[model samples]
Target: MRKNLAGVRNRLLQVVALYAPGGDSTRVRLHRLRGVEIGEDTWIGFDTLIEPSYPHRVVIGRRVAVGMRVLILAHFAHHGRNRESSEGTMDDRVSVRIEDDAFIGPGVMIMPNVTIGAGAVVAAGSVVTRSVAPLTMVQGNPAKPIARCGIPLGLDTPIKEFYRRLTPIEPPAE
Candidate 1:
């Protein structure tokens, strides 16, 4: 009964956090209560979905910005390799980590077993399947690195400086 109650409560909190009345703070607070390891000053935008089954497996670092309609998953259900979950489901446990100063653009979907390194940028509508290197910018279906960054594009950084600091990824030699 206790375990079931906890699961119910967690789902309730998740539902509230999804459409939480206030700003980032409210959503962050609610998610924290639901067991997501969120760092200080991180902003979670409207309708962002963290891992529903195992919120504790998702970690967001300080000053990270998760944009609207983003989906971050921390568990995968592969039939052959799946492990039994406490919730009576079968899944493979994987952590989705976003390091400090990372920017996840709107409509992005981050799959399990991947980390977004510090200062990395994931462009809008990208689908991230692998780990991103620190200070890199990525885009597209599998999120290929487009450029390396000198600094994170935070609220305080100037847009011009952000663009100026980007070094494009050199094409491979033929």
Candidate 2:
């Protein structure tokens, strides 16, 4: 009964957070009460969905910006084929941490066990499957590194510096 009541309360808070004003501190507070560890001055945009089942697994660092419609999932099914049946798929839970000063763009989906490094910028609509490096800019499905903003570690070229650098697709010359 206690667990069920907590779940209901958490759901209500989520609804309130969705409807609450963007600048309202109450919205942030509600999420905190729901067990999401959001740091000071972090801006969680409208419709942002943090892991509801494991809210405590999500840790948002100071000044991080989670854009509208962003989905941070702390749990996923190991087996994709049989999603409905509990026996078919095993549910795995892992913590997700958005480091300080990181920027998660709108509609982004961050999978479990991912850590958005400090000052990293995730482009809109990105699907992050793994951890991102600090001070890097990532985009596209699976979230490949596009550029580095801070001082390079030791790589010769720009592309070489990335953790998983992908060749940019160029447009056909007209």
Candidate 3:
């Protein structure tokens, strides 16, 4: 009965968080209350769907920005057709960790067990399949590294300097 109640409460909060009246603070507060480990000053944009199954497994670090329509999933939710498996949490499920100062662009989908490194940039509409390295910028369906960022794109970092310091990665020989 307790478990069921918790699940229901989580669902309610999820819905509220998605369309909450306030900005980042309101969203962050709701998500944290629902079990997501959101750090200081992180921004969760409109309509972002975080882990519904295991919200505790999704950890967002300091100053991270999750764009609108982004989906960050932590578990598969359905391991198989087995009733027992569906009823209980998967023991082997891994957490999806987004480290400090990362920027996840709009429409990005991050899968479970992947660590988005600190200061990494995931471009708009990308589907992150694997772990991104620190200070790296990635884009595309499978999210490949596009450039190495010299500084994290934060309020403190100068816009011109950030752009100037980017080192684009040469495409693989085809």
Candidate 4:
């Protein structure tokens, strides 16, 4: 009763916070989300988009950080193509998942049927066409692994530590 009401209220607040202009505190934007479970304390940045379009489901693990303008698509509804096709069945939609503690940078794009392992880092503007392994750091257009996150890149410090110290600089508003 009371707990149910509170849960509903909280979800409504989250939706409003995500869509309201100038409301920057909210972390996630969900559209037609179904069967996907998002973990606790995850921070989904502004302009991030997520959609679940398949029966297999899309799952998001805890403590994940998704950067602004990142696009996570679980499926492609090929309704237009299906209508034109002579075949009775159409190959359309797939599921996607992101494991715990994963960090996806801004402008990153994740396609369907892929799972991002825990502690993985996807670089900015990278297009993730395949599954990323755990604790790995991937970059580039096709999102290849440049290095492991916690492994030393030569300076006796891990690349993950370097990324942790980085502060993204915001541009001046027009």
Q: State the lDDT of candidate 1 residue by residue for 35-145, as single tens digits.
A: 999998889988888988788888899999899889998877545434556744333344798999999999999998899999999999999999999999999998899
Error of 4 at 92 (Å): 13
* Candidate 3 lDDT tens digits, 1-174: 998999999999999999996546999999999999999988898999999868887889999988998999887666552434443545334479999999899999998889999999999999998999999999999999999999888646788998999999998999
- Mind giving the per-residue lDDT tens digits that candidate 4 earns over 1-174? 995765465455545544544312333333223233677666677766565233225677777777877787766665663453454333343367888888888899998778888878888999998999877778887888776665312223466776664434343569
C-alpha root-mean-square deviation, each candidate: 3.5, 8.0, 3.2, 10.4
lDDT of each: 0.89, 0.77, 0.89, 0.64
- State the RMSD for candidate 2: 8.0
Error of 4 at 168 (Å): 22
Candidate 4: residue 45 lDDT (0-100)? 71
Candidate numbers, best TM-score first, in rank order: 3, 1, 2, 4
TM-score of each: 0.89, 0.75, 0.90, 0.62
* Stretches of candidate 2 exceeding 4 Å from the true structure: 77-94, 151-174
Worst 10 residues of 1 by lDDT: 85-94
RMSD of 3: 3.2
Better of 1 and 2 by lDDT: 1
